[model samples]
Target chain A: MIDWSIIAEALPAFAEGLKTTMMLLAISCGAGLVLSVPLAVARVSPHRAVWGPVWLFTYVMRGTPLLVQLFMVYHGLAQFEAVRESFAWPALRSPWFCAWLVFTLNTTAYTTEIFAGALRATPSGELEAARSLGMSEATIYRRILLPSALRRALPQYGNEVVMMMHATAIASTVTLVEITRVARDVYYNHFAPLESFGVVAVIYFVLTFGMAGLFKLVERRALRHLRPTASGVA
Target chain B: MLHGYLPAILGGLQSTLAVAATSLAIACVFGILGAAAKLSASRAARTVAGVYTTIIRGVPDLVLMLLIFYGGQIAINRLADAAGWGYVDINPFIAGTATLGFIFGAFLTETFRGAILAIPRGQMEAGQAFGLSRGQVMRRITLPQMVRHAIPGFTNSWLVMLKASALVSIIGLDDMVHRASLASAATRQPFTFYAAVALIYLALTTISILGLRWVEARYSLGVRKVEFK
Candidate 1:
């Protein structure tokens, strides 16, 4: 039988780390949603200049690994004396903020694609009907387009969140004391790499597995109206 | 600093491309086999294929690469020792390629399986009616359609595998990312080097996307529906 006692004892520390993970996840997701919508919109904008920067941003972010991007933002760009003198330095200097920054941008690249695909999937019929009802272009988009695209985007956007959550483990490389860092410290102290990592792994597993379950529930809720037979049966 | 390191980074880029290309070829074999296995009626084969994909998908690629590069080599070396074998060594180059090929094959398996499923069932029946052998039916009827169906997913996976080829640098393969890291550290120009690295990756991906488009056009010519431009 396995030792339940160890896990019980480790619960508090694991919970603390879990909180940090959740906060970082939230920051990345929140920032990502705000950033990605504009990028997605710009990506499909008719104006060349509006979309040009968006294309370059998405291309660079998507092409490179997040580890390098994190290094670039936290270590590389910070190397400039001018940047250090800038007001943004304090925020950039903080490891948490920097990790969030890199993750936010990374998510922006992925979420831009997801949102663009979702926007493409939005029903044209609804848009035509809204236009015929004398809705202004901006109001039609505001009330009709945004809500519909958001609903379409949710499932894939959720996957982006999960990927970012997993990506957070690398933040420890830049000296952020997340779960991986804490586990490394414990491992060095105890000389039991497997045990320490195992403890931390359980926390990560619980987080990801729980998130998966919750997302499935949300997916079912989102799709319930689409399932005519199931809705009628229910 | 840039001039000094250009040759070294260029040398590393060759190895990165070599490993990715070789692994992708190896993965193609595993992908076909895995797709067939998953589609087989045998419960055991399907279950095995499912488990292989599940484990590969759940584990981080870096962690899997580390395990194979280190843990796999240790096991191989120990087996060699116990057998009193000599003059045989586990090469990281071979090991890294195999590990990446193994991981990416699981994804390709999924893609190929989906592609095979997407083929209309009647196509095979029609092939049979034309008196083609089973082999001919697969080769002439199914494989072409599967390739067409597989292109988009295959392109996405190829792009991902190209980026992931960087992780092998951790296991001591002198890939582009590894050389770039050394360059960044030595030059203290992390942003410039990283930005350059990003552009190189973009160039590779752009070239690959163009190649994929050519492949799709060639393969899809007979079946694609006409649309007004």
Candidate 2:
């Protein structure tokens, strides 16, 4: 029932779409990871002054739909004459920039929460030991807390990355020619939704499982110390 | 111009709610069945549910929506033609609702399965010792407690589903997002319209959070609240 000819014709387009999808995923996730580290640290601070605004920011970002956020950055911004005439207009007008900005902001909010939870779960004894060693709060955080929290946060962060990859499909709504967009274009051209979307589905399935497998490998290595020895009996 | 279109945008909220509510009901059905299948002794049933959750979670909702709406339409029509039943037109409402329900059902499967597993094994055994039928045990001992445990995950899924309802507009469901786009186009003020819609969504989520919190409290009435040291 599937159209092989259309699939053959669309192979190159799908490959290009996959490249754009990966680019979007990489840029947004990389930026989100960098931004979330400090935000997550701030989120766990004892002083409300340090954490209140960050909490509010993450709350709003998490509460709203990412699609609305994308629209606000993309179609919404271009509505204003002042913005259109501003120095940042060229970047603002590009769909790629808008998608990247939204995705980064979106993932940062989520990852910050993940990291904050991990940070909160750090053993009190470890913190006490650091303080007993005459380490300053800065040193304690920099040298000990953040690293351990990040290690604990790895699995959740891996899930976030895979989610971000799936979320990049929404970028296609803004005309960013990602995998979903390619599928839509092919469907329109061939009027063969089965063939067009089926191929796209396979590509996404492979990417999703591939990501899951990679994370599994990373977890195995990073968490090796925690694993029980082969000869050990519980 | 936006002032004139405000009513139209507000009207779209009705459609959005209808779709969300209907899909949520359908998803609950799928979730229960999925949980049952997963917990069933039959290997085939377990595998079927496994594949359902795997495929649904692996694919993006938009892709699934497009496939079901467009592809399902063509497939149904082709079947109809062969069966001498001319021109079967699939409604976007049905397609959108079914796809959303189907997609979220996979998530709910996990939530429901986890909640069921959280119930103590001894509780079921105790019910059996009391000579309660399996159905009686499920209803009396397992299901009520499951609600308390399921609420948090259910709330998370519901909130996400509410936000996801915006996606229905892509398939021409005339939801809030679609209305906002129309208003934006007509008013030449995309920012105003989009921002307005976003605010409405935020309000919905906030209200939902409060409502779900109340439900959680009600369900946890007799449960001891552990005070963290």
Candidate 3:
């Protein structure tokens, strides 16, 4: 019942779509990881003046749908003459820029929360010991707290990365020829849902599990110390 | 100014809520069955449930939705043809809800299974010891206690599902997101309408969090909190 001809014809387009999807996933996740570290630090800050705005930003971003956020950046911003006439308008006009911006900010919001939760769960004794060692707060975070928290955050962070990969499908709505968009185009042209969407679904399923397996390897390396020693009781 | 489009947006909000609520109910049904299957003695049932959740979780929701929408329509029509009935058109509402229900059901299955496992085995044993049937023990003891453990996961799923209802617009359902798009196009104030829709979503989520907290508290009435000094 599957149409091999349609799948063969769509191969090049699907290849292009795969590149776009991967680019979206890689760029957003890379940038989001960098941005979220500081925001997460701020999120767990003791002072309201420090963490309050960060909390609000993450809250609003998390509370709304990423699609709405995408539209707000892509379509909504273009509605304003001031924004359109501004120096940033050229970049704003590109769907790539808008998708990158929205996906980065959206993933950053979630990653910040995940990291903050890990930070919050840090044991009190660790902090006390760092203090007793005459380490500065900055030094403590850099040397002790962050390393531990980030290791603990790895599994959840891996899940977030997979989630962000799935989220790139939303880029299709903004005219980006990602995998989902390619499938949609194929569906429209060939009237073949099984060949079009089915192929894309299988591709996604493979990519998802492949990435999950990769994360498991990273966790094994990073979390090795937490595992019981070879000579220890089973 | 909403330019008299506020009412239209509000009307669409009703549809959005309807989709989320109906989908949640359907998901709960699937979730319970899946959880039971996973927890059952039968290896075939466990494997089926395992594959169901793994496949559902691995794929993107939008991909699955479109697959269900277009793919499902074709399937239904072919069945109709075999029965000598005319072409069958699937309603966007039905397709959207079914797809959302199917997708979120996987997540909820995990949630419900964990919740069931959280209950002590002794509770079920004692209920069985009292001469109650397994079904009666499950209904009277396990399900009630499971609610407390399930609330947090359920809330997370619901919020995610609520936001996901926005995707139904892509399939041609006139949800709030679709209405906002219309209003934005007509008014040429895209930011205003989209931002308004976002705020409405925030309000709904905030309200849900508060309401579910109350439900959770109610369920935890007889439970005592552990304190560490």
Candidate 4:
């Protein structure tokens, strides 16, 4: 039988670590969206010039491992004295910032594809209607295009968000002290794998479950018009 | 510098590939067994399969790698001392491979189980009616179909397994990442070493993605006829 005392002992530290994990998730996902929005639009550019580099950027980021990418920015960027002297040095100097930056770029690659796919899948009739109404490009994007594209992308985007939460566990590689890091510390201190990892496992499960539930809520809200009344009530 | 770079990275690549190959083979074998156990009627089998997947899946690869490698070392040293084996030292490479293989086996278990379930029940029934032995039926009909069904999920997991292989560096394995870390530390040209590592990983993944897609197409060859709708 597993001892409950170990869990009780680890709870406070785990909670603090959970806060940092959430911070990483929030910043990465937020920054990812900001970066992806332009990239998505650029990817669908009618001209090859805009689309080519955007696609390559997404591909390279998507193709590589997050840990390697984080290390590249964190340790790699410091190699260049020019980069060290550059205005961006201070931002890159911080491990936390580098972790977030790497994660942001990684998530951006995934989100750009998701959002771009959503944009392409937006109803042709709707686009035709928007143009027929003489709506400007900005107005069409703001008023009609993005909203429907977002609605279509909500479920996939939710899945991506949950995956990111799990991926952030790797942030500890850069010494972020997230939930996984705390678990490692506990394991080192007590030399008890089952007890330490068990606590961390529970925290991860709870977070994953909570994120899934939140995604469900967002999905329902996005598809409210499409859902049956009985479905909504339930 | 450029002359030495490719050769050193290539040596790391060979080692990384060797580890990945061994682990992937082990993972697939376990995947089959676990998937079969998951679909077994025995409650014990189901429980074991479920627990194996849940615990591994919930934990990240790096954490699992550390725990298993360190824990195994401690456990083995104790056993060796008690048995007078005279100070056995476990290799980091073996530990890293075992960790990746074990964790991925859990994932592949689910993929294989889901694939087996998706097979039409009537096909198995038809095999039984033809007076085929259970083994014969499984070999000819069930296993092949399951492989086809398992391909897509297997591909995704395989790609992921490659990336997860990077964690071996932390355990002091002289894979590409470890070599890069050392190279950067020795040269103080962190950008050059890590950028080289990242590019190598990207190259491997791009090639892997294409290869997996080809395998998927191969497995999916005869099964594309029927539409679900």
Judging by TM-score against the true structure, name the best candidate. Answer: 3
For model 1 the local lDDT of residue B124 reads 92
lDDT by residue (A11-127, candidate 4, tens digit) is 899889999999999999999988888788889889899999999998898778888898888888887889889998888788899988888989999999999999998878999
Candidate 2, superposed: residue stretches over 4 Å from native: A229-234
What would you estimate as the lDDT of candidate 2?
Answer: 0.92
Quantify how close model 4 is to the true structure by its C-alpha RMSD in Å. 3.6
> What order do candidates take by TM-score, descending?
3, 2, 1, 4
What is the C-alpha lDDT profile of model 3 across A1-234, one tens digit per residue? 998999999999999999999999999999999999999999999999999999999999999999999999999998889989999899999999999999999999999999999999899999999999999999999999899999999999999999999999999999999999999999999888999999999999999999999999999999988889889954
Q: How many residue pairs clash in each candidate?
A: 0, 0, 0, 0
Relative to the true structure, candidate 2 reaches a TM of: 0.97
Q: By DockQ, is 1 or 3 better?
A: 3
After best superposition, candidate 1 residue B205: deviation in angstroms? 1.1
Worst ten-residue run, lDDT, model 4 chain A? A225-234
Rank order (by DockQ, best first): 3, 2, 4, 1
**Quality class of the docking in candidate 1, CAPRI style:** acceptable
User: Which prediction has more favorable TM-score, 2 or 3?
Assistant: 3
Taking the tens digit of each residue's C-alpha lDDT, what string does model 4 give over B92-134?
9889899899989998998998999999999999999999999
Best by DockQ: 3
Task: Report the poorest 10 consecutive residues by lDDT, candidate 3 chain A.
Answer: A225-234
Candidate 3, CAPRI quality class derived from DockQ? high
